[model samples]
Target chain A: MGVSVLQPGLATTVQDVGRPGYYNVGIPPSGSLDQYSSLAANLLVGNAEDAAVLECTYMGPELRFGSPATVAVTGADLPPLLGGEPRPAWESFAVGAGEVLSFDYLRSGARAYVAVSGGFDVPAVLGSRSTYALGSLGGLEGRALVAGDELPIGDAGGAAPGRSVPEALRSTHPRHREIRVMMGLYDHRLTDGGRRTFAEATWRLTTLADRTGMRYRGATLEFRERVAPFGAGSDPSNIVDAPYPIGSIQVPGGVEPIVLHRDAVSGGGYVMVATVISADMDDVAQSAPNNTTRFVEVDLRPGRRARRRRAARLEALREALA
Target chain B: MSGAGGPGAERAPTVAIRSPLPGVFYRRPSPDFDPFVEVGSPVEPDTTGALFELMKQFFEVPAGTTGTIAAVAVADAEMVDAGQVLFTVRGS
Candidate 1:
């Protein structure tokens, strides 16, 4: 007994914390865009934090449950509907056998995570159920869900319904966000004005966002004039191929800047001016098309502190759910 | 910016069609395509009123009710917020 997909959402795929320690080998750590939200959904359903969950994009799927199970929806503000009745987000609820579960239009944020009682019982690839659709690696046959696909559910557990995350601890997605970044990697390549504009300008996210990377437009960045190196391309922003860290910001042609995400290519030739702070990666993931972002530069001290704060928040969720 | 109680005030009862998600709203599916709806255009509940490109996905926004397009609320390719009215339709 499992969930039957009636109408697959825009891009529903199975994902967990991710398959780490494999980036050097060309496999990205493909997983949920917002790990905290995913973990919260899993914890609320009494599943392990790394249990595979459905990562729904702008739209959500229409599913009919084959058996009774506890369910939770978190991340985006996309509300779940059970048998056409509205259910709250960030809270665990129940679905009876044969009940249809659907979702309303996304109200905020860009992604939502759906957690089932036993999690989606999909075979793990490279120790992860996470889907890297580009390479067709994991999840159900390694791609987004389609109609008639029956997702297997793990053995039912004792997670009770009505458990909800505290409001204060919940994630909020505003239209305009100020994301913090650590400047370094290729900052020296940008002119003074380019650096100032990058720090001061408000960039609007373009529709070129996916698991791979998110592209933004607004102010144009100027690179310092330099003779082309033998190994690099002629474009001022080009450099010899180098490993790209997740959340790195690379501007191509000195125009649109793209921030690589969880499923990013391991190495690229573009010049990455800065990296979004580790703590703010989720925020980057939540950004929707046309949403404005002002990148605030921060030093390693604050960056590490932000990471600690995020860890503490996760700890608080664990305590509350426990 | 298309809604009732405007410069000349309301003359007829109209219904507002709002965008369900935040994104760049396009009046036409693409630049080469005609606008989905226009003033005086008759529409049904399932009629595609507009499109919003979010996260590289183009999602169609249904008209939701049978009516005649009375006024357009936003310009082509305008960035719209969730729940922001995109069209006002007069019930037939």
Candidate 2:
């Protein structure tokens, strides 16, 4: 049976690992902002790591189950409630038929993932069940959840309640974070002092943050004065439209710095100063507005090592749960 | 807690209004506008006292109980956590 939406929270949508190999056609790889959290929720519920789960933003949704099922809530500190009683996050719990599941106020982080016993049974588009709301592409009708909407649940495969990730392997959300980046693409566009400020000065996360991009405010960056080349705009920060990789940092008008995220447009005309390493993308996703961040530069070798360490942590999580 | 009043009447208890989500709390809708409420301002259950900005979206924080504003707890543009008290009202 399916679940009925009693009240859709701030921006709840269904997401999975994401759809890759479609950026060449202007479609972004829309997926969970915090991939580790999403995967952890899926594994806890005995579903495939790529199974679709509900992504709740700062707020959470209220739903009524149509049948008995196992459920788990992960990512953020949003507390889950079953039948109006408190339930631990990051651990599986059982919900009976017609039971209502809700959430308390978010205590930390920016988003939460909800995984049912059998995952959400939405049809996949472009090989993904993730929602790209801007393009109306995938997920439940290519939009966010609304009141009265019924979400289908797949067949459960032996998931049990009380399974939880170890505390050591769980992620933490802090008010201030230091994110590592690789200074390469278009770094020459900025002056030496500008580069130092980018690395040294603390940047505050602005309210203009979402799945597509995150904007930061702090010291103003100065671009090296240059004559506009053919096809490039007159602004010193402009470049002939180049492909934007996920986690790339771009500054427009030398003011606010923006980091492209999972649902970012494939190509843009802004000058990219640095790229956040893949290992730290989850950290960036968890950042809330008003949080402070500092950028640290790293080389390719260290970046690759961090990625490996992250993978190892995931493996540890799997082993612990097993 | 009750304060003595004439003929067995007691002082009204103050109710705290907390934010529903974490964000930057603003007293005004924008920089150019006046604050939505101030101390001593009367309010209905649906009255909005402040706005919380999250991911560039503004959510109005409504007063859930009919009361008179007794205190404003947070300053404009201050970062607040979820369930943080924003205002205190004395029921009418």
Candidate 3:
């Protein structure tokens, strides 16, 4: 008797596959900004690739199903629907009891995930039920999916509805996105025409973005005037605070840049300049806000072979949804 | 309203609504309130009908159908995005 919420789109939360170690003290590891389409919607709802699910941004919530479940709708292309008909999106679909599910509108990526079967039980916190709604920490109670709430699910795990995750392990989102990055920590505080205007500008993604960082706006980058040090603040893009990493990038007055993602806060003081490469943090979480990225500039052995080709495309989408 | 084959020649279904996210939008709920469902009123299905905002949070926008307002399509504070539309209900 769970999955309730009736309209909580635009930022619906819950997510999973995050909350790693606690970032020294500040916390920031929210989770599932497209973790390969939230692990192919938990392997097409049979669950267990980190469970928890939901995520939906660029709109899609409305849920209902207080009984029969087995859902799936992976990242973006935002289509979903069930009691209202039109289903299929990264496959797997069933719902029933009071059915509903909903969503439509956002064509092409920006965040969608969903999953359902047994996951969404919501509890983990530091170990990760992953919502981190700005540190309120872990799913549900931490916030986001509003309208009536309910959620609960967690029992079934054998509902693989049709499965399907192939199309080359699916993951496209592109209205121009490039992404990649690697450069250096604080990128030597910039120069060399500010890291060539931070790896030759193009940026854009800005409506500020969400899970904590994204900002961008076509490059003004330049930094490198130096002379601040002791506690470093005088903005040559500051620095001295450290940590960040999830996809880092920072830039501050050098003009816009931001990129941090997955609820990042872990550490700051600005000055990052480059990092983005955990196999393109799911292409910077499906990019969006006006999309138009481009950071490029890799190395670190092609960012560890693009994170072992995104872990062999999530182990071939868990053996093609097993 | 069920037309396409008789009765008063029907009509109603209009729907639209949109703007589930990207900021600004707002048709009131503040700034000395009042604007929530105007252009002909009625609304219902969970109510609220407009308020997106962003970065400064806000959210609401609901009006999930059961409608009447047939036209508001954004303006007060504008901005919109994430599907756009903003209103045109008629539905019921």
* Per-candidate TM-score against the hidden true structure: 0.94, 0.94, 0.35
lDDT of each: 0.91, 0.90, 0.79
Q: For candidate 2, please provide the TM-score of chain A on its own.
A: 0.98
Per prediction, fnat is 0.58, 0.61, 0.33
Off by over 4 Å in 3: A1-73, A76-79, A86-109, A112-161, A165-186, A190-213, A216-272, A286-306, A309-311, A318-322, B1-19, B22-48, B53-92
Give lDDT tens digits, candidate 2, residues B2-88: 222323332677899999987899999889999999987877789999998887688999999876788999999998877789999
Clashing pairs in 2: none
- For candidate 1, give the lDDT of residue A3: 95
Tell me the interface RMSD of model 1, in angstroms: 2.4
Ranking by lDDT: 1, 2, 3
iRMSD values, candidates in order = 2.4, 1.7, 7.2
What is the docking quality class of candidate 1? acceptable
Per-candidate clashes come to 1, 0, 2
Find the candidate with the highest TM-score and give its number: 2
Model 3 error, position A167 (Å): 17
Full candidate order by DockQ, most accurate first: 2, 1, 3
Residue pairs that clash (backbone atoms under 3 angstroms), model 1: B2-B73
> How much of the true contact map at the interface does candidate 1 reproduce, as a fraction?
0.58
Cα RMSD (angstroms) for every candidate in the order listed = 3.5, 2.4, 17.0
Q: Write the per-residue lDDT of candidate 1 for residues A100-202, one digit (tens) a residue.
A: 9999988889899999999998999999999999989999999999999999999846498989999998999998999999997999999999999999999
